[model samples]
Target: MTLSQDISDIAIIGTGPAGLLAGYETNPSLNDSQVDIFTKSSKIGHPEHCSGLISFEGLQRLNVSMPDLKKKIGYNSIRYAKLIAPNNLSFRIDRGTKAMIVLDRPKLDGYFAAKTRKRGCNLHLKCKIHKIGYTKGYWFLLMTNQGKKSVTKSKFLINAEGIHTHLAKSLQLPVPNHKWHFPAFQAVIDGVKDLERDCSELYFGQEFAPGFFGWVIPLNEESARVGVAVGSWTGNNTRKYFYKFLKSHPRLKNRLRKDKIVKTYGGIVPGAGPISRTYHTNYMVIGDAAGQTKATTGGGVNIGGFCGRIAGKYSKKIISNEISSKQGCVDYQKQWRAFFEPNLSLMKFFRRTLSFLPDKDWNKIFQIASTTGLEKNMKVTDIDLHGTGLLNYAFQPKVITKGLKLTPHLLLSYLRGVLPD
Candidate 1:
């Protein structure tokens, strides 16, 4: 390939699932004429970091929703979640059907990339965007790969780069508010003991994963993804903390045979809700770069996928002259915000309150949940995408009473932010 200093219609940076889908959604007229997608990595998805636990609804929304992998990558369709406390008090929420699935993320991304490529979008892998600037109605990007440097131009830029916001920040784009950065450490273990492939588990305690928590998502009857995340308020000692957690828990210690560990993954997740402004000039930011993640669980795939489509659609409108590019960017942000902000606010409220709690508070909370049948009231379809729905339980006297008993202060915090009475 040779360099051509031509103006591209749109340039999508990053080849994560969101970026790949964004390129795919770019109208045929716009993309076939002029669109380019770039990724710094040699492959679509690698050094995979997610637990790969996504809701059925989320998968459908992503257009990647499938019952299972084509290559039989192995997955456990989850129907239950066992929330465990420090003292080992646990409560199970069972949906009894396939509400979510644990998957191989790398393969999932590859599937989307293949589909996007079929749509005729130009993909540049192993290309890194080092800097970006705007002038004369075009965005100029300084890119490099294998000691080779080149500059590219685009009328519009869709930054779907996962959690890294360097491009946006360098371009002087607005960023999400910062209070805590959740860094995770994970281990893919096989030959586990006493673990159910269909039942995922969440462990909570400040010492284990301050601010966030730890999780176990089984991919099969014998293997699962296990990880822990700690908030930015704590230092960047995620690996140290994860090892401590693995050693401290009786169940984890026994189940994770020293020789059974298969792999490890590490990554950072931004939490505090999405940024206020995701559009600046001819720019539209989606995915983690826009912080379109659920604060409760710090996952972004579904929400990001949903918003990426909106961005792609409007980008086409801009190219077709149906709308101005600036307005298209504005509408893109507006569309995603209308549906996600309120839910994100709710999740953020709970996250902030929970982040401050000590280990003992979690024990008390779990104790209340066990006694109140809260677990029974929960539907298996509880998706992290809408944290606001969790508050619906307030309508139930038993649930509310039990919640209040566990932490009146947390309830008060909720009211102050959401109810204000």
Candidate 2:
């Protein structure tokens, strides 16, 4: 196979948000350099599975524009979220602030791809990369499609191949430990009425979603994306629970009877941060491949875009020799960790503690959160390292009190690193 001349300084695997964002962040006029993106899918956004809920701030941070198809469901101010016990006791939370926009996934992905192409990145659809290796400081990519093969080389490689980051895993880059993985199932339903215009619904309890929670995010007046996520510890198939929950929940039973199913989808979410390392000598990983999704909420669009931008900028530095050391790539890892690690670590702690709590304890915590205003608590939980002393101010009391109460068990669990077999 002969190499393509258009394969420029960076070869990005996957044309999802991460790869697209990386391309957008690259300096376009760098001596007529090409940024080549390869994807196995012949069509972009064909197998859409994401819920696509994101904050307005997240969109701006990624520097990606919104599409016309996005319908404003109003701002979601979560006054109280409940964990309903099997016995029907409800633990509720009242958090302030709002969880913003629910997007159309296909539109969002297409928007990013278009922006990336407009920025002069070469996007190759249906291109499956089989192998990658570094030679004389240049990275070589071997790809094939339809029995035809091609080769490309670049100074750096960015692996944004979603959860199945084949290239990074082959190189033995630290993929997230599988124990932290949670499976999610989603389906879009139409013909619903009297649904909360702005509010998203979350059901957290062992009976409903043993390890994680279930959600109903309204996308428009008549349609909604309803799903359930089960932590790996529960040993439950999330897809099974998705149907079971609809069948069992009285409220949803009627809705299901009335609504027609439009789409059904499922995927695994890495409910943790990266495994200490996300970069090697000449390669970087982003998005689900790097486990950038939030532990508590399976949200990754923001984090993926943030890391993609960082990786894109760092790629430029590495190629330009502005920072001429292997550590330049390491610095990219550092930048992501500095921004995401602390919160993700804290969130992992919370996930552990919450998972072990009995129904009564969960009810108590939810009751406290409800009284405190969930939206406010969400803002605190969403805090990144770059943000204020707000984490200390907002969560110190809760951490010292509730957090300390769970410390001993949590410490043991953390050290054991034991997950369900």
Candidate 3:
């Protein structure tokens, strides 16, 4: 059908997991209206930007299944890690047998999109919705594809568009004060030299990635995804910092110097936190577009997907006339924030506190980790998408005692973020 011919009860912009899940659960096929999804990319998971690491536990929480474990889905598993400090102090962390895993992100997203389509949602890829307006209780959308313009309408809208949400502003909803982003660059390398095949590494120091941290995630013994995130206060040019990180770090240079760069991509991720408000008249926002990423790690797939499911369920209720669109919108924010806010707040604090520390402090932190057997805890536990796992670090007398001596303000900053606003 022509684009102009499209009409729906719910329209979703962007095809990320958040939008796909939202469309999947909110399919309006039962009624005269439909749950229609539109994406700017032609491929299922192209224009790849996100770091593709999801904990196995995260998969179960998303209610999705991987058809293959060692074959098609994830080819590598992480059980050992080297947490290197600025002073070359390192802490070894192993998740016993398997700590974390890497996903073929593009394939994963494509898999879900196909499943969502089969679930009865009309997913239009390479489809861009440029303009939106509300009139007579309907959202009029101006969509374009290959220079062709088509008009469509929907009673409700789901905004899963990635960072720098254009719709939230175009719709003139109450926007957030500012969007803090982690300027990051990632590349695929043929070999991650000198590092353990199953061990991932985190390099800490302002010199490495001023605001955030640097990482090496192994795809296999011969390949890995290497990247770094620079905080807003430090600078926005991650490429420059990435170069600095490569040349200065001992292991990174050894691994990357002789390796071929398979591919490289860069993007911005929501760093400050979720937007202040994520609801409007007949609209709801989810995913990176709404700052639904984990504050500590900048990963959003699982958390955003979980919230997207909530959005989908609520949209269905709104379509069924069981709740008003406005009510559904409010509930979307409340429910998502209820489950994530407290954790999110603590994470935001943790990230900020990390930024506040210097290389010496990082050295102290890892020193404690190595001596205190913190790595033992990680090797056996599952991935904590929300950063709750780090809480165990604070309970140690020696760790807390050293932390206070090194960075006394850390506690104050933690309190500021944790105390309800």
Candidate 4:
């Protein structure tokens, strides 16, 4: 059918996990034309920018079945992590069981897109929605593909465009804060060495990844995704930083067979928690567009996709007149933020505070953490809601008493971070 032939009940942009899940949840009565999803990318998960690491609990919250996903998308299990400091001092956090999943992101997206289609949502890849408007009681969209323009209309809209917020801005919605955004780069490589199959490594220091850190997430014993993200304050040379890290880091360089680099990609990470507002009249935003990414780790699939599910379910209600547009917008905002926002806000506070410290300070912090057992206590036990875990460990009466006696200054910093507005 032509774009102008029928008016959809709901329109979604971008086919990332968020958009696809939104369409799936909408499930407009087996009528494929009632819900339309659009994206400029030719494929559902092409040019993957996300790390694709999510907690098992996160997947459950998004209504994803691991057994089903394993058979379809395939994934790597990560049960531990090695955190390296600037001075090469390091510590390990062992969860003793699979704590994270490294997904084949493209395949995950493809799986969801296919499922969404089966649920009666129309998927229009290579079709970019360039403009949108709300008139009277309907939403109008202008799009183009292969140099041909098309127009469509819907009762509501969902924007899941990731870091591209131009459309959100055009709609007069509040975008994520730019101050916390960072440029990130990564390379998939084989011939890796001296790395455990179930462990991910994080390297911290200013010499290589200034204002941020480098990571090696092993897909297996001989291959991994090596990447780095630098704060916006570090200037725009993430790729340069990445290459230098690959070549210079003492332990990391020795672990990777750099010559076998299979592919390189990069994207911007929005770490500024959620924007002030995620909804407006007849429309809502989810995924990276709404800044639903984890502040400490920049992973978005879990939270973003979860929020997209909420959007999808609510969009269906709004379209069917089960709820007024205004009430639907309010419900969507409250429902998503109620469960995820507090932890996300805490992580953002911790990250922003850590970003200001110098390399020497990081080394000192690591040293103190090791000696005082802080590292063991701060281990991230809950991947989906890790801030609560970290906070519980740090704020325990015994831990606080020890911190006050052993390192009053560091304790003050920790206190300030938690209480920051």
Candidate 5:
């Protein structure tokens, strides 16, 4: 059965962080508009992946309020970091304030989805968008569910479909080259008794996570989320290698009394760098789909939220005819780049250097960190990562010097590799 409907002013694909944020920002006053969201999942939040790590500023900026902090143990701070080296050298960072908070990933996404729904945004779950095409200045979307098909027409489209963007690829849009993708695997374990409450741990040894790193992010005292991310360049099955690494780690093995695996999740992280162009005609991409994730830390929630909000705000202008020129889309791209390009560029350089570094360097770096409080010195708030600028952290001399040295390398790499033709 075919049902024809008028084209919407905006159609958002994927109900993840970017899509939800866009919906909320578009009509903060809860005004009615022709907006529709489509998602393949049966529910708003399911099959959860992601470590759910964020900063205090991120929560505030995203307007997320968690009344039960204890329930969200994944939300914690890095009061101190202990970096262990091959030579047994360790570095520690003891900062008084909490540097990060981990959230319940599925719950957080659900919350965002709820907020979007409350604001009158139409949500279509379990709907798989198979093909998207444009004709006569209007975009057409073909979606199917349970042997049934439906069509959605929109004047503007936002692709928030995460790492795999079939719509953008179909149109031959300028997607970033997949030069530095990483495979990440995570599991929620229920019986870790000795995990720290306020601090998270990371293992940087090549043996543990070959092109990337391993982490134990505490959800609370009783349970923790353990995971590893390996760069694709390493050529290892991330899931298999992560389990092997977990079985070998004496510290992790000893604390595990029960091996009750709650869930297993894995996904690809696009670390190639942000897309050189985020917009084309009436379309834009955001979040992981746009390569907005941090290459160094694999963090994108804050950046994604910021970009989604910006996109939402801009969508109004496009709909209202305030900015009728193609330059409106260009303006959106420029604003997004202005906010995230620098940090992403720096992260790419750091990821490349770290990927190629010998295990000894990690050990040395950890050792230096243990003694010099380097982690403390370099502690950045979520806002800093989300275009707050580095000037706020300029007081610490060593951190400043290190960042300065890294800036040139990042800029050079961007120039040599990522600059638009």
Candidate 6:
């Protein structure tokens, strides 16, 4: 069990939930000193970009509790979402369960870091790995720490570096397509009118957020997080698109007051499903780096956290010599896929179908959904498993009959859209 100072059993790049969870999951198998989590940021959770809407079920599966999060850092409960079509038509989806909550994201990361550290994982903040190489079954990471350069070696590597896939690309892993990566922007603002504390709203339109959508996630009665994500192919500035959405959207503009900004955050979101390969002989990729995000919602925390836990559990096997590193990596890949691929793949298909539909088609679809009780039948049992819920709703005899009756063209368009997938 003895080792050199510069060497570790595992080196995790990035201190996000994925990396922290990966470290935490190692547990009794690997001592804390054997795992090192490196981050470019100086703190555990800084520069938060997520809207922080996550399912209590998902968080529970990851061993995170609402009470723990609330007692440490506050969060808000949400049970409904309003989906607005391009033509201003909308429908309300009631999630009839105690499943969703809005997290104080920065603190959430801090919580994960605290847990990981308590489990004996080493956290090396402000240490950015600039270059990485594999040689003789060990990964060498060239890093800069507080302006000084050094190298560290590890038997295994976990990439949790979020959306910038530079490290994954360097390892020759197929990164998510650039076209499907949307630039997203959001702001915390006060003085909001008619804020629904328990409801979040999604606005869909090309003029505002092409190939994606805008969202209003209410934090409280007086303030909310408003944001927009736009596709790269639109040739539009995401900030400009956000400004336009803030100032001109028919329903949203009326709800905001001028100069009421509290804070703003922006980042690129991956809409593609999980990458083609997430593992190799001595390394694995998790989190946004591996595109472990929901294409439908651009949410990665829960999905990536699941994958990270798999990687963490597999790490114990690899480190304890219970399994070869290569087999462990392969198993990690297979396990995560088994846990989330069906839903992620289905969500990707839905995203593609929605992207192909025109605004007029959206209007008709909304009309049909309203008239045929499609929205009413959408009893989403779990927010993270939306694909399954949607499938259950789509196959209803009444929904099928009404779709064929009212919007056969829309149905045909959907069939055509399936061909591309």
Best by TM-score: 6
Alpha carbon lDDT at 52, candidate 6? 91
Q: Which stretches of candidate 2 lie over 4 Å from their true place?
A: 1-7, 65-99, 233-236, 325-327, 356-360, 371-375, 379-420
Candidate 3 stretches greater than 4 Å from native:
1-3, 29-33, 68-72, 174-179, 376-382, 395-397, 409-421
Candidate-wise lDDT, in order = 0.79, 0.71, 0.76, 0.82, 0.72, 0.83
Q: Candidate 5 has which clashing residue pairs, if any?
A: 74-102, 75-101, 75-102, 76-102, 85-363, 90-370, 91-369, 91-370, 92-369, 92-370
lDDT of 6: 0.83
RMSD of 6: 3.1
Tens-digit lDDT track of model 1 for 254-358: 777657779988998667677878888888899888888887788777788778888888887887788987788888877888867678777777777787677
The candidate scoring highest on lDDT is: 6
lDDT of 4 by residue, 1-421 (tens): 2468888888899899899999999997643338989999997799788777778778888777877777988889988878899999998887657678888889889988888988888899888888888899888888887678988888788999888788898887898877678899999989988878898888887788765688999888889999999888778789889988888888877777668999999988777778878898889999999988888878889899999999998888887778998999999999998978688878777676676556777787677567666656655456777777767776767656545644544445445444534
Clashing pairs in 1: 95-380
- RMSD (CA, Å), each prediction: 3.4, 3.8, 3.4, 3.2, 4.2, 3.1
**Model 3, range 151-177, lDDT digits (tens) per residue?**
888988888987767877877764432
- Could you tell me the lDDT of residue 208 within candidate 3? 81
Per-model TM-score, in order, reads: 0.92, 0.85, 0.89, 0.92, 0.86, 0.93
lDDT at position 149, candidate 1: 88
Local error of candidate 4 at residue 279 (angstroms): 0.8
Model 6, range 1-421, lDDT digits (tens) per residue? 1223677888999998899999999873344348889999998877788889988789888888767977986888888888898899898888755657888888889989989888888899998888888999899888888888888999889989888888888877877766678899899989999999998899986777887899999898889999999877666598999889999999978888659988889988778777888987788999988889898888888989888999999987898889998899999999998888688888877776675566777777788777777666665446777777776777788777766654555456446545544
Clash count list over all predictions = 1, 15, 4, 0, 10, 1
Name the TM-score of candidate 1: 0.92
